[model samples]
Target: MQPATTAVIALHYQNEVLHPDGKIRVGLDSDSPVRQNVLDAASAMFQRARACGLPIVHVRIAFRPDYADLLTNMPIMRGVAASNAMTEGSWGAQFHEQLAPDTGSPREFIVKHTRINAFFGSPLEEVLRIVDAKRLLIAGVATHSVVEGTVRHAADAGYEVLVAAPACASASPVTHQAALDSMSLMAQILDANALAQFFDELPS
Candidate 1:
């Protein structure tokens, strides 16, 4: 894909989600290889995209301390408030260093979302329009949640979606594989290295 028509969306690469010391890491069963060094894979993908002049949009999930902005309709959503996991302005909610955006950069956009699907109630679509991007490369933590959610939405909305499987994972290897299998129907599944090779083939 050409740089001008493609963009990368980095999702939930936050301390509360990706870090070992994250508050939400307690009892999380992410021992799978998919979760290991996952951020490094994503970071390298970002570097390649940047080198190709592809814009990146960083999406985060956070809420007010009072949970005023959060809708607790499920166990996971309730857990966030109960554990104070994704409180806005908290250290846990901050983006992880490996994939954090370079703020003030013209091509990087930071959007805060309150839903599983990044586009729902978020400025993601508007950001894509701003960048004139119709194809997306997505990498995020909890492959079954935010990644699958966003991929499904983007596919249905007529966007060309590619999921970097190596850069994504869920709480379990089983869950992560299942999600990737399901997403393969709607999106192209590529590893970070393959994606880099594809990007390199683009004409200068």
Candidate 2:
């Protein structure tokens, strides 16, 4: 039998505040935009994936209510601590509306903790196995962190990896491209539109 079809994995995309310094501070501050270019690509990718009947999974990064573990581990959580940032009930931790609808009402979402990689402490692999997903189409923020981490882990896990080049961003354009280049050998880098086209052409 043919290998299982692709499943789209969108990572660490929260409804967040875009700081003037370009870091996402994570909250419903005035810095928030209803949408951004990267999110636009993700929305389009989701629609295309659903239309093609491909499985869709969204991964979010969040912390526990007390944040006791993250504070003990990363400590950066304290430096950036806001009541909203990374907290489950806050607007900052919520999924962007566009991606939210696709992940809910039918599809399921997997949540991760402080780890940059989605699979590090999450049941993402189990979910993929449940769906028999073969390939992953990835998109998200802070290309140097969550995106980079997931790409490396997914490759090591033997999953076919595809990065949506335009559907991701980092603190800067230079770092973004650098991460892409570093992972290029390990991943098939493609634009979101190209990924959509590939799924559209999948044999039924």
Candidate 3:
């Protein structure tokens, strides 16, 4: 089979200081812990994507707290009343060390911020369009939010979307699974190893 030119997308909850603590106070089902596992899986997936010369994109959540001067009001940003942790320039805003890629130069980072979906308010769609990417491999934190948001928009935009089952985590297991179940009907869902195998079988 021909190698599918793909883009691997990962969402990061670790923003600067103005964003909410995505899962610290949440329950066991919360995404914090699960997000880590998802990230680990994504890292492994990236190895295959890299070998296939596919593009990798990381979505970040960062907000300018000035509600008076907001860009577009998205569902996730409805409560702009106060910022929790993710800001523009804080350690918490940074991507978890494990999920962050080493590009050897700060100038080139996969990180991109958006108000809602990875494609919304961000240059993601444009980038993919430039690369002529037809398939998107997605995994991220807050399956209910970023992951869902991205998938819906991606589908509407007419791109083939795939969700990395083990590469996603949400605030609750129910929410996570629900999102997966729903997306599965519209997109292909695969784990890291399965994804790797797909890429491996692809002809160069």
Q: Among these predicted structures, which one has the highest lDDT?
A: 1
Question: lDDT by residue for model 2 over 66-168, one digit each (tens)?
Answer: 7664644455456445533667676767776666744343444565657768898788898888778878888787677888999999999999999988778
Go through the candidates in order and give each one's C-alpha lDDT: 0.85, 0.71, 0.65
**Taking the tens digit of each residue's C-alpha lDDT, what string does model 1 give over 1-204?**
233788899989898877777877523644534445687788887888878788899999999989999998988898888988899899999998878898867889899999889999999998898888899999888889899999999999999999988888677778888999999999999975777777888653
Candidate 2 is scored at a TM of: 0.82
Question: What is the lDDT ranking, best to worst?
Answer: 1, 2, 3
RMSD of each candidate relative to the true structure: 2.5, 3.9, 4.3
For candidate 3, what is the TM-score? 0.78
Worst 10 residues of 2 by lDDT: 19-28
Name the 10 consecutive residues with the lowest summed lDDT in model 3: 17-26
- Model 3 bad stretches (over 4 Å): 1-4, 13-35, 65-75, 78-83, 104-111
TM-score of 1: 0.92
Measured with C-alpha atoms, the lDDT of residue 95 in candidate 2 is 73
Ranking by TM-score: 1, 2, 3
TM-score of every model versus the real structure: 0.92, 0.82, 0.78
**Candidate 1 lDDT score relative to the true structure:** 0.85
